[model samples]
Target: MYIDPSKKPYPFCPGCSHSMVLDAIGRALEKIKADPRRTVLVSDIGCVGLSDKYFNVHTFHGLHGRSFTYSCGIKLANPDLLVFNLVGDGGCGIGGNHLINAARRNIGIKVLCFNNLNFGMTGGQHSVTTPFGGKTATTPSGSPEKPFDLAGLVSAAGGSFVARVKALDKEALDETIAKAFQHEGFAFVDIWEICTAYYMPANDYKKQQMDELIASYGFKTGILREEKGREYSRVLNSAVRFQTSDVRRQTSTTLTATKFSHTLQKDSIGIIVAGSAGMKVIFAAHTFGKAALSCGLHVSQKDDYPVTVQSGHSVSDIKISREKINYLGIDKPDAVLIISQDGLKEVTDILPKLDNGAVVVYDKNLQIPKTEAKLIPIDLHGLDKTVHATAMLAKYLTLNKFMPIEALRSAITAISKDKIRELNLKAFEFGTND
Candidate 1:
């Protein structure tokens, strides 16, 4: 049984069409004899999201409206798995872009959108698919917005298969869902349903009313569109080929033979490189991570910056260890490199809490917060502000005895282009000499 015996008595409200839809999905999966282990049920926040636990198959419940995006990633990463997204009309509206793009790409994912016409779980608020002139909690008199013809929209967006079926028609729902599961490319089924708790009481809606409403909107029922096309992952795989030997030869040619003789004082070392967005702080941290990797140490690096491009503070957290690094987060950094006032402000709260004996390297011009860690100041009067992160990193590595300076030089050479490489190397030299 696809449904877990332990999770019997599904959580949907009595007379809720979601329960019927869930049963239809289970029956469809059984009819196709789909492998539960290879099947994934993706859902977002709503009445639909509550259905995952009742199914024994692999499941993912994410933020409202992001189910399609997650399902796309799963399908692209491993195309053999059968992926299905059970989302509500609210989710459809919130993630409309993802839905359209998924259809355009024609990825092999079955989307069963529960079109109940309202945000049933949150309130009886009208949704994107709510029929025009339909009364809802938010639309007391009637909805001003026109409902989306999901089948038509998906068909126009290049979906290989599209269907619209009433949730109460058990036989048709089962057959349509099974067909969607069998489709080779993107398949979308707009499952018309009624919210027993909210939508029904508000509009006195029922199965008969649903049919009339759909007809009035000029929306077609049954299989609306079906056409064969190359599936997205298959096409992508066929177009790209990896030349491993050439890649290995290129990597070997660029990397220098630099050895590390010093050992880490702790089991793992955390380092933070903070600067303004355009200052290459992330790049410098990545280069440092590569340098540590070349010394046979496990490394992980994470970067943070504002959505506004090249205009705000940028920070990167790096972890290096003799053992494999499991978690990338750095609760307390062993070394901190601050290159600008923006960066100083970003890490001000963290400085005072640093562990004793930790090292901090900062621009000599910036006033630093109180900290118990060892402090080293470097003057950046002659170098470009963009390379300040590189210089500061070099100085920290030199003083902290984390890795040999030659490793940093090798990384700079391997990662940077002609002029950038020259500038970075010069910055490295300045840091080491200063």
Candidate 2:
């Protein structure tokens, strides 16, 4: 009854062993008393993924072999939440690296993989663990390679808990699932399900002979491994919050402030600042947007950064408009700030689309090509590009009398720390005087 059968009817093949796995998960959730709102179920594209709707939990079905990747983010965003990944053999077969790495990272998550010995989502086909010498749609002559060892891989990869449960053993599977759910670090459960619609009938496999079938292959059941390890989130929190005791907040009564809200005008602008990631370009954009919010103006800011977080060029796109800004993206940005050669390259990529009067702010150190857009160049001298660029941009806005100096200052003060606030205020003064 926990499952909303009216809105999300159970959709599984007749006699499919996947239902047992679903029941185990439901029982585990019930036993743990997990909050429906705080529990996220990320599943892959297969019969297992179909179970996503069966539960009232917030669920997302992702790419064929990357449900765990999505779950990683879900857990990271809300570390207090209980996250589970439901994937199939196809996901594990192709996502072995992801699985191993997630284990090694000891992410605080539970992973349930329905291992039906073949790709059960599709017709009976050779999957990541297709029997080495068994027949399937893709391997009519039988699999020549060795079937993957999912359990051993997770155990060796550093999962805090690992288990292989037979689908038919409902009590054992549910208990193991509950344990996995309670684990502090990464927990993996490999449930061997029979594909009644495909894999079962492919070899004339009968439901009555399942015990014999399991015995022949030495199929595993119950908790295979369990250990205690520092969870990824716990370790990360310790590192992030270390020596940060001064961040406690004051009483809401003392923090409260009166507000006069006003809408933005049609001439509202979009500004982009681009440079290397470590240069604080994203933070600068965030500061500016937050400042604009303090001014009773509408604003939105977005950042683009590569995987490395340090070496690659970064971009912060900000929009400020008077009226309800219909669109956040600014294809024809009103202004741009380029801090390095890498930033200039990104600017050039969209140079042709810039409007006739759009402005370009660049580092004087770079050999920027001439353009019809108004050019404002600054010398970095190895100084922070955020401070210098924000100063210059704020000065331009104040001089044009389009934006208020007090509003900008109030914003800067509202969001910045002591040293940073003092430095930025001085920078604003310098730009205003310049």
- Best candidate according to lDDT: 1
TM-score of 1: 0.76
* Residue pairs whose backbone atoms clash in candidate 2: 264-322, 265-322
**What C-alpha root-mean-square deviation, in Å, does candidate 2 show against the real structure?**
6.5
Report the backbone clash tally of model 2. 2
lDDT of 1 by residue, 149-181 (tens): 888888999999999999988889999999999
Q: Model 1 residue 98 lDDT?
A: 93
RMSD of each: 4.5, 6.5
